[model samples]
Target: MASMLEFRTPGWNPYAVKYSPYYDSRIAVATAANYGIVGNGRVFCLGLGPQGIQVEKTFDTNDAQYDLAWSEINENQLLVACGDGSIKLYDMNVNDFPIMNFHEHKREAFSVAWSPVTKDTFASSSWDGTVKIWSPARKDSIQTLPVGNCTYSTAYCPSNPSLISAVSTDSHLRLFDLRTPASAQYHLTAKIPVHVPSPAPLPQGPSPPAVPGEILTHDWNKYNHTVIATGGVDRVIRTFDIRNPSGGPASVMMGHEYAVRRLAWSPHASDILVSASYDMTVRLWTDGSTMPAQQASPVKAGIQLGIMNRHTEFATGVDWCLFGVGGWVATVGWDERVLLWDANAMLRGQA
Candidate 1:
């Protein structure tokens, strides 16, 4: 809501944007041509400056990239997920070409996430219905967890190196434990159906059967590790506690007119989060629940803090600045624009 600093990715539609953990001013964007339906793609490394945002470096790829992850161990390195079923590791300090490449997924690699806890490993999810774990030093995937459906997002738990979470086209959120046996399907510890209907009978006219749709994105709460937020084609954002999967969503936030495409929890607040949607708007919300570890019941129907309507196309990616005063956020969309704004001012009507 603050006066936004905007930059456009010429001829490309951005898919994912991530702020570097080691550098608060640096951000990376994964993008594709023609909204990734066909054609090539690029990854842009950008920097925030007094003049606005500027491109620091750019890399071109034969296939569109759907997602990217900054290296947890090396500030100069990052990984990109490609439509060609490959993951490429690039070092910003070196030449433009990737220094390492891994091709194991049989379909487009949709998401990539570096381990926040281990700092040496990363994971990727693919349309091939598999999530693979990797280390940059290794030439092959260390492990693969089959989810039996197209997986759109995968990430390592920030608090536990041995744990990972993923959302798939199966409309389920799954948890895997690396400590378990590595077999045909890795250790799937939990699976929560995202669109299950209420157990209580409906009160009025014919109740529409529950509609199950693909979960496009999800993120773990940085302050409360047990809490996970998921959004999808249903246009509903729901938070769940992994420790009590049977209890359904702890909180549900609704307002998006179209499918929710991306979400990120505020690094500074346990209850604050932001979402981007195909409706062409970015929204901020409070999950309306105290940390389950700290309280017994969660407040339902979270509050919408504000909405930013600057994007003209589907908003695909969103990330929070880890070092800011806690209101700054970066969002990229199919409109080919990346906009940085301060959510604190947006919520207070001061921007």
Candidate 2:
């Protein structure tokens, strides 16, 4: 039987959920009132116990919180990206207020990511069309890489602190190498078109021309350092190898009936991933790169494994727990509900 737990935020809608890198029982959620249109935001530090999920701490913000990231070095500290272009660092041990505020972006800060390798620096992407690199000890950003469009997600390469990637409304995935000289175009080394024409034409008629769409979320594969997955307004998920991005997507997974809101590559498996969508469901998928011949298909390079449809509103955020047996997952949505479940149990034939 599958085990599941839930917690409701009452009036606030959660935009993102991140599991604590240090504690299995702890997680943080970024939320906004009135579905992030125009209201105050709240960040919740929640604890899981025998009694269930409980709020351990809460920080209210003057603007909507779109995304957050847990500090890799300090378990008690986390960062929140706000609608007002401010990024705030909160210390769980503190009472009622953020410990540090880093305001630089001229537009809404859409995403925040802590460097898994450096453990000291973090990055934030914004509607300002740039991704800024910063340190918790600094008052201003260390570097800003311009995306020229609304950059929705940004993450540092887990294996290389010098490498960072970001996706934007321009339907492009850009890779920046901080090791490159500043004169070399802001350290931007590669720009891969996220939407590419399908290799094969449909049987009945010609395949529709590929159209660019806004990319909302992306995540680097933990085990596969050169691989990254992207999802967006097109309702399709695509994976590409940073080394050979011109060769086109290594795999494509299509199933979501609405735009894909967020995606997370599993920490424990190279081929497994989970996605949350506006369709109000969280779906599991395998990239088919590691599947056996009979299990993989040419038309569908990646296949959906299962679906969890308990959310009553747009399923915006989903994340995998870094602890335990590795299948425990946490998801949050516009329904103001957070659901924790064992994903391994939902797999088609897994025992």
Candidate 3:
């Protein structure tokens, strides 16, 4: 049911938004958590202490990070899926260069995630509507992921290596159980009832059917494996219990004025989460079930959450360090600045 395909080339750096692994505060014991701003081709790392930014290293890469993941393989290895349909694996261990790279997509790779269950295993989804499970040892998609739309983002369920959650541009979130056998063991079959609902009548004359929206981005709680969050261009962010993505969202966090761009859950705490948006704002969400009643559903909740006004431009990337002393959150933007925030500050301010 699986095969291997191999090739060798330099990794891609399309967006250059790779986040550093859970980094230790002690510089001597750290590999230096960094993010590369692709537009300017500048690589950024922490400046030490609480405020201010610094440049740890710089490299000339001509691409952007359409999708990226921090590898646990080593402190220095980072993988980035670029807009050019190329995947670049960088090894700071190799003089700040990509030690392994290849083209894995026919279109811009929109989302990627590193497998927490396997050392070298990872997966990627793209505008091509095809999701792939990859390992350095394989020749092609290990278990060619089956989906009906373009995947905007994907996250691996760290607790269960076999499960992956992806959001498509079609406004739907999907979960793939890779452990389920590709053949008959986990096959999907459904039968429609005899009373089929009439399709919506076409407008006026004989026009083509309108295309539907797709799911966008998603993440899983590291503390609780059952909960996953998804965002879409429809201007909504949804939290779904993988057991039932459709039954209803467990809790909806809303605040972006436009399409939600990215979502990240703190590895250190389950109740804490941060989101970025094209609306030029970053908002934090909590487990407290106090969202407004009218905005309780996915239809309204995506636009009701509170907004955090720290960044001054479109936020392209957001991440937090679980192992750091202060457990700081960082956001990079089109403004060419990477701002770091102390999550505790906002928590205490509200108190």
The per-residue C-alpha lDDT of model 1 at residue 14 equals 99
| Candidate 3 residue-wise lDDT, 39-67, digit = tens | 42323333343332334444334555565
What C-alpha lDDT do the candidate models reach, one value each? 0.89, 0.91, 0.56
By TM-score, how accurate is candidate 2? 0.95
Best by TM-score: 2
Task: Give TM per candidate.
Answer: 0.94, 0.95, 0.75
The model with the greatest lDDT is: 2
- Any idea what lDDT model 1 has? 0.89
Flag clash pairs in model 1: none
- Span of ten consecutive residues with least summed lDDT in model 2: 200-209
What local lDDT score does residue 19 receive in model 3, on the 0 to 100 scale?
47
Residue 52 local lDDT, model 3: 27
Which lDDT tens digits does candidate 2 get at residues 36-152?
Answer: 999999999999998999999999999999999999989999999999999999999998888889999999999999999868899999999999999999879998998889999
**Cα misplacement distance, residue 1 of candidate 2 (Å):** 6.9
If the candidates were sorted by their lDDT against the true structure, best first, what order would they fall in?
Answer: 2, 1, 3
lDDT of 1 by residue, 201-263 (tens): 323222223588989999999999999999999888888899987777777788899999999
